[model samples]
Target: MVFEKIVEILRNYKEEPELEVTMTSSFEELELDSLDTVELVMEIEEAFDTSIEMDGTLLTIGDVVGLIEKAIA
Candidate 1:
């Protein structure tokens, strides 16, 4: 459920109808800049009703899913 939500958010934020977003897809692969990442984090937090602390380790969609799980757990 979380992964799907994240994918939706990514798609909406990226506005790339053809972009294939998956768990293994990295922010680099998505061409998201640091500001874009920060904005995405904000959107994720709002969607999940939780907070996430950004770090260097959050590189992929799976990494963010893990973070959201940990945050809400």
Candidate 2:
């Protein structure tokens, strides 16, 4: 469920349904800037009913995926 949400968020931002949502995909390739990252984090938090600290550590799509998986777990 979390994975699908991540993919959906990426797809919504990219406006492309064909993009792959793999662990190694870079957020930059999806046209996600710092503001987008913040918004994504907020959305994920709302979806998961949890708060996530947006440290400077999340640098890629994989990082976001990993964080979501960890939060859900």
Candidate 3:
């Protein structure tokens, strides 16, 4: 579920080069700008029906997935 939601967010920016998302993928590799990150955070909160106070600690796709799971749990 977490992976799916994250991929869905990434798909919104599919006009860019194709990216192969993986647990180790970084946001830099995906080329998500600040606005995109904000939208992603908002979409994630809406999708999971929870608030995520994002910090710089999350640095990879796995980190995001873990954070989302932890928040929803």
- Top TM-score prediction, candidate number: 1
**Candidate 1 residue-pair clash tally:** 0
Q: Tell me model 3's lDDT, rounded to 2 decimals.
A: 0.75
Error of 3 at 39 (Å): 1.7
Q: lDDT order of candidates, best first?
A: 1, 2, 3
Off by over 4 Å in 3: 15-19
Tens digits of per-residue lDDT for model 2 on 1-73? 6778878877776688888777776667767788888887787777777775588888877787787778778
In candidate 3 the C-alpha lDDT for residue 9 amounts to 71
RMSD of each: 1.0, 1.7, 2.2
- Residues 6-41 of candidate 1: C-alpha lDDT, one tens digit per residue: 999998998876679888998999999888899998
My TM-score estimates for the predictions, one after another, are: 0.92, 0.77, 0.78
**TM-score, model 1 to reference:** 0.92
Candidate lDDT scores, in order, read 0.91, 0.76, 0.75
lDDT value, residue 25 of candidate 3: 81
By TM-score rank, best first, the candidates go 1, 3, 2
RMSD of model 2, in Å?
A: 1.7
The TM-score measured for candidate 2 stands at 0.77
Better of 2 and 3 by lDDT: 2
Q: Name the 10 consecutive residues with the lowest summed lDDT in model 3.
A: 10-19
